[model samples]
Target chain A: MNPLLSSIFSTGFAFAILRVMTPLLFPALGVAVSELAGSVNIALEGIMLISAFFGVIVSAFTGSLFLALIAGLAAGILMGALLAYFHLKMKADIILGAIALNMFAAGMTIFLLFLFTGDKGSTSSLQSLVFPEIDIPLLKSIPVIGEIFSGHNVLTYVSLLAVPFFYVLMFKTPLGLRIRAVGQNPHAAESVGINVDRIKLYALMLSGMFGAFGGLYLSMGYVSWFSRDMTAGRGFIAIAAATLGGNMPVGILLSSLLFGFVNSIAIYIASLNVPSELIQMIPYLVTLIALAVFAIRAQRKRDKVGEVLEHFDPEAVKAVVKDVIETEGDI
Target chain B: MEKFILKYFTLIRTLIAILVGIIISVVLIYIISDMPAYSVRQFLLGPLLSRGRFANVIENASPMIFCGVAIAIAFQAKQFNIGAEGALFLSAAVGTAFAVSTGMPTVLHIILVLLVAGATGAIWGFIPGILKAKWGASELVASLMMNYIAYFGGLYIINSHFRDKDAGFLVSLRLPETAWLPQFMPGTRLHLGIFLAFIFAFLGYYFLYHTTSGYEIRTTGNNQKFARFSGINVVKVVILAQVLSGMIAGIGGMTEIMGIHRRFNWQMSPGYGWDGVIVAIIGRNHPILIIFAAFFLSYLRVGGQILNLMADVPSELVLVIQSVIIILITAEAFLSTWKNKITIKEAERVEVANESVAQ
Candidate 1:
């Protein structure tokens, strides 16, 4: 197994990790925006599912991959706005709204599959355009890093490029400030006439655009065709990445890479005659472990902060308790 | 009776939203697919044309009753135990394994499966509850993330351990006859689970609204600090709510498997855990109301399937309609003009009071 592992790295397993991570990286970036905006997009699964469906269908119909990408983006925008409308203006619970959208996407896509191709579960027969790999001849000639980075879809490059760009947009811009402000304290932002709702809406729309791009990568870029449940929890993994990264762009990138690495190894191990089902479960198992660990760490920090506050201002705690009781009577 | 009418106003709003949402969904379908014979009315009435389809609706709603009441219990305690999905799957897999492998009398077999399923689900739910209570983990994230772990982990077990060699599909071996639940409607698929659903609905109502423990759970949900001050262990209450919710969801899995499928199929549920969320909302977290909410949703699902079979329309339109209904119902401003009148009355009172005080 150790020899196999060493040979596996030499045999391009590391590069495979990057290629696998590319799909996850894009949506994780989108998830970062949504979570940072304080509206967790649980519909990422559905968005990616529908986008992958439409991306391949539209491309197959129009015979143009670019058009398919546009259609994918449009679908993502629609889902994002739908979720945002429900969560932001409608005051619907975020997770509930997301679950509805996800369910809708799942069932609708299957229904549409039956309507369009007369297939119950997949759309593999469509004449869709597959993305062309980028030819960085010089980069390809270079050593390990070049092998890892070169020869991918244009969308993959864009997803990678988004990491730094998103960092700048999230931290360095006025719009970013407004979004963070809304997430942290919408009341304060509203007091300052920040149009907090509008900021959240915009953030959600942008998140949709990125999520759709991730979907496009899955359909036209990776598989060249769409299958039912094609995204297969990649959207959820993106969400896990975003949260694990603490909703930071760079952190999301790193988290996506970690997930990608685990997924690639799982695939490799499954292919090597290890039980495929157990191997397939590895990524999800690892995600649960990672989430539990992260939750514990965060909980510890919160408890420590509470302890410090209690020691510093015992009277404030009593005041809070009194205020809570008063509020209780009103409810 | 007048108070009843007032209490039922929200129910009326729900009906109107359903109508509007169906209308919009039909319009979207007609525009996209160019079919007019397949209208919203067909979607509303298609399933009721036959007894078999009617039974299907009840069979579907049976699980909704369990999970919906489970969610209602958690909502009472203000614990969002979204892990019901995970709990349901774990129970189904474990219960099926036990049923298929065990050799026992019919009655004992059934009881054992239900008990084991409930306890397993409770353990699954308890993890997140304790995590939230002891470590302050966000129950929402913990529960939701745990769903995937449960799903994939269950898949691993199914593929390796429970794979039925003689069974044609990727499903478990059929349970013994002793483990099977008795059907209620003989020819129809409806089983004794419907009776269980009724019992659960009443039990949930009594447990949440009548019992002292129920009051504590609700009080904790309403105000944690206040509940703590009132000598209630808020943490214990939240954890108990999760356990109760999980047990109810576990029974749902047991009923679904033993009564309907007879085999453990992983994709048996089309996201019923999430649908339970909508039912809880429309029910206003009331147990009695859950029966109606679950029935309404199940009707839409069964009716939509019939409509799709009879007409050229896609069954997915029903889902779009359901999402719209949820959105419309949850919106603050979607209430009728009666709400506007109440707001205006409050405003006028404030204005007149100010005027009198000024003098």
Candidate 2:
């Protein structure tokens, strides 16, 4: 390959990663909010799965990408509400509810595939609305940054925009404080006049929006069509990213971008001289390693803090123990 | 008498949950599809109309019982081992691999395959266990990620190394007949896996409720600090739960393959581990209750298939219904009030009786 072409290829590879990571980012954000609120949204994978299908089907039928996006969002909220209802109201286990949603999504999507396109593994025949490209005229004039950021899918930009919004929601707003409070100490929040369950519900709803956007991107922006398990392990990757990023918006965006970068490289490598199977495993493998590293570091931090607090701050230790006890009683 | 009353109360509440679930399923079918009465009947009574189909229900329930109990065991230990799916997939592949490669006596070969499968699953589950124990990693995320690796990893192995060239499908070669699990019912799809599932559930009950280790595991699950205060090795207990849970899930995969498919294949499991997780919760991590929960789920599967054959209704409706049921049950609203009511009634009755005795 020519030197210039090789450089361009690498750049394109980098762009592909960005494209891939965009879909993963939103759901990860959703997972972050819900997890922070002490409600583990395991159904994110299922939500994305159904929403991807609905995004294409509704878009193709109506010839409106916006409508399809709305429909997808509705579908995600439905799943999220269903999950929250069971988890918060009916007292169902979070993981179990998620599992049911996953199974439901898997089967329903396949069934609908047969109902709509008569295909089991894919939905390629649908003339779905593709998200328009956002070309920043002024930004394009910039030298290095222009090429990197310009001419992307509309949802890609939205995903980027969501990061700051999530940060503000999680830290700046009363709702965000309530969500964090509910997650950290639900009883304390309850004592402070916060309805812990209600906070969780709101957090889950916000999460559904993020998850729905993820699904919309998969169908309308990333691929123009939906395939079975198309979001693949991205939902789980998002969960990993959420944890790796320490459940913060800025950290999540960076983690998601890094994952996207890894994904793009993996795709590029697979296109070249590489075994497709091994290449396929690359993204998941990276997630595993990244998560492991993040976890180890977090554990070390917790241990060090505990050690310092144990001797230096007896009152703080007592307060922490009391907080844990209160939380334990509530659970 | 107390045991009988407790069992009956459990049964009654379960039945009510099922009934409520049925009503919801009917409503969904009515809205999504067309027929109301027929679909409702099919959803409710479709599983018991035939012998073969009924057996199919039990057969499907078999692995779920294994996975559910396995999950329940871990849940009791307070270890969230979500890699039951991964464990099942990897173990199935290992079981099939051993069956093909090893030439031994019939009994030994079968036993060896099961053992190897269990070990593979245990190891797969053990990685996250060790991570959570030593590194403070979240098992939920780790196990979820590992599930994908194990799933596609098994697929890669089967497609590359064990691909049965003669078979057109993406599957491995058939195992030797000697390694096949015996059928529980002749001329039916049901196999000895059902018996094993029952044994595992009973054994799970005994192990969890009766053993010293079980007490330690339960304490560890209930509260780590408390367990630590009691001098229990919480980390070891949690890790053990994961490993043991994985072992059962591995055997679940083995029983599934050895009893049903006879070879490794892509789509080895259709979210059995996930279903097991739900079943575990619905059963409240109790062993015997898991049996009923598994049966209830299998009824839906078998009944859904029946509905598909008999009516124009899509069988995916069952999945939707099952999901709704699980969601409703887990939502906490449906059960919490009932729990509160029952608890309150018991308290009132006790106070009245004490007053009467004092008088």
Candidate 3:
């Protein structure tokens, strides 16, 4: 009944989906980079919050967008260093440490926010700068596709471009190969004189960098100011994106886009007089259903004795999908 | 002496972590405040400055114990469930609805509300448990996702079905006097819920250490495949443990609502579930230790709040310090390094004994 639902048929909807996907894509890419190296970053949510806070406060004080950006990224890397110190050096349980780091980020950012501007809920008092959306010169004159692609925040283009960049960095480079080797067989990699801890350190730091970009994009690009707990579990959603995508760069991009579409739908539904609370549940419910389907398909693969494939097999996947649909129909 | 020290090594490490956490927090206090000494005094002794303040610590720990025990039970079953927050909110809402809408004998009404909370919580938890058991879904994400759903769903329920017309807020109809938890202290907010929390902790300890089902849950947690090979119903144990965990969290939230507010309110459970995780980790997932950990955390919170009120320091500072303590306490490196030192010393002692025997 909502008029906004009709927008789904227009190019505006496509543009909105793309815009929504940009923030998720950056973190999902980071998750893919780290998880493929066998060190999952559960602190993405915390890292994002820290960066968003620092991005605004630092920009307010320095009055330089570049320096603020660097400071924000540094805050995320600092999270990685803390994780590495507790998880690697102190030998803490990695997930537990990550969770604690998240809490620390949540609390520290608010504490610092109060210190900077006497605001506990948000950084509305600060006059922080945001990145300008670039209208591509040649692309602006293109057909329907241009409307969906042009006039996005600078980070949006960078995020889409980083998909291929990550693909090559992960699949084509020696460091990538070494990271995979260390992950798959630490003993073997160590015997070959590859420093395992050093590689893990490198992976964590890189993961932190990309994770911070996603966070910085949220505060400095998506919104003009920072808000308390503004990440709203997007970091976890990014992990879901990475897992659904099988930790591949291209897969991450597509899955993030899929999630973006769902998120857009959730927003559109909000206009239909549905309570805002129920509307908020849509994005999460969609994620749960998608993950359930993924799990069921993985189970089916095990039953068929076709060990889980690294990439999609069209015929096999179609058969599985048909079988699931038929079984549900029967029930 | 050596045996005793070795037996309590984990405890010693946790104590050290807590001391370090406090010291770092004090240093931060010094940096943030002009009256460093006064700030430190408030942070340390503010909770005990008066009976009312000390009672605040007890009141805060009541719900914490509920959530802490909930997390401890689930963790012991090898299910990394973080859905207790959702379970708490939904269960409390359901319980409060039943309490406010229905009238019965006072004691019977309370019993019914508790049962409603526990049952609703179990259903909430069982969904993800069943998904994980049947389809191999990652319960962690499934449960985390479930929390958001529960949060929004609970809020919707309050807004549509239970809203108090004259209250002017999103809160629900207040429970009748029959549902109110009796206060032992006439003037304070301290209710029998604090005692109930202690009871839950003690029962949890007993259930974990003494029961056959507990052994099954523990084995499943330690190694699911091994437990299956040993004839334990691994799937059933996993689901059941989570159900029980949810029941505890539900009771916790209901207790807080009935005992503290006596009204249906749907706000998320004060991050008690997340705090539950930190306390459980600090307690090493032992039920008895979780009680102590909950006490310590709530004490820190009350003290921190007093400091926030007295000085310009934010109470959120305790969260930072709490995270530091948890990370340090759970670090396995200290245990491993200590074990290595003990092994080396034992080897030397054996060699010396061999030399003496030869002589």
Candidate number achieving the greatest lDDT relative to the actual structure: 3
TM-score of each: 0.86, 0.85, 0.88
| Docking verdict class for candidate 1 | acceptable
State in Å the error of residue B77, model 2.
1.7
Residue-wise C-alpha lDDT for candidate 1, range A94-128, written one tens digit per residue? 77778778877877887778778977667787788
Chain A TM-scores, candidates in order = 0.85, 0.85, 0.84
State each candidate's clash count: 0, 17, 0
DockQ of 1: 0.39
The lDDT of model 3 is 0.84
> List-wise, what DockQ does each model earn?
0.39, 0.47, 0.56
- Candidate 3 per-residue C-alpha lDDT over A219-297 given as tens digits, one digit per residue, 9 for 90 to 100: 9988899998889878888987887776778788888998898788777776666676776677678767877887787
Report lDDT (CA) for all predictions: 0.80, 0.80, 0.84
The per-residue C-alpha lDDT of model 3 at residue B159 equals: 75
* Number of the candidate with higher lDDT, 1 or 2: 2
RMSD of each candidate relative to the true structure: 5.9, 5.0, 5.1
lDDT of 2 by residue, B1-359 (tens): 33344446655555666677777667766765556678778767877777877888888999999999989988897777788998998889877887988788788888899999989988987888888888877788788778878876787777668879998777899999989988767878788888889999999999999998889899988888999999998788888888889999999989989889888865545678877887897687999999998998888877777767776566776777676666655555655566666767777877899999999
Ranking by lDDT: 3, 2, 1
Q: Give the per-residue Cα lDDT of candidate 2 at B177.
A: 90
Per-residue lDDT value at B278 in model 1: 80
Report the C-alpha displacement of residue B196, candidate 3, in angstroms.
2.1
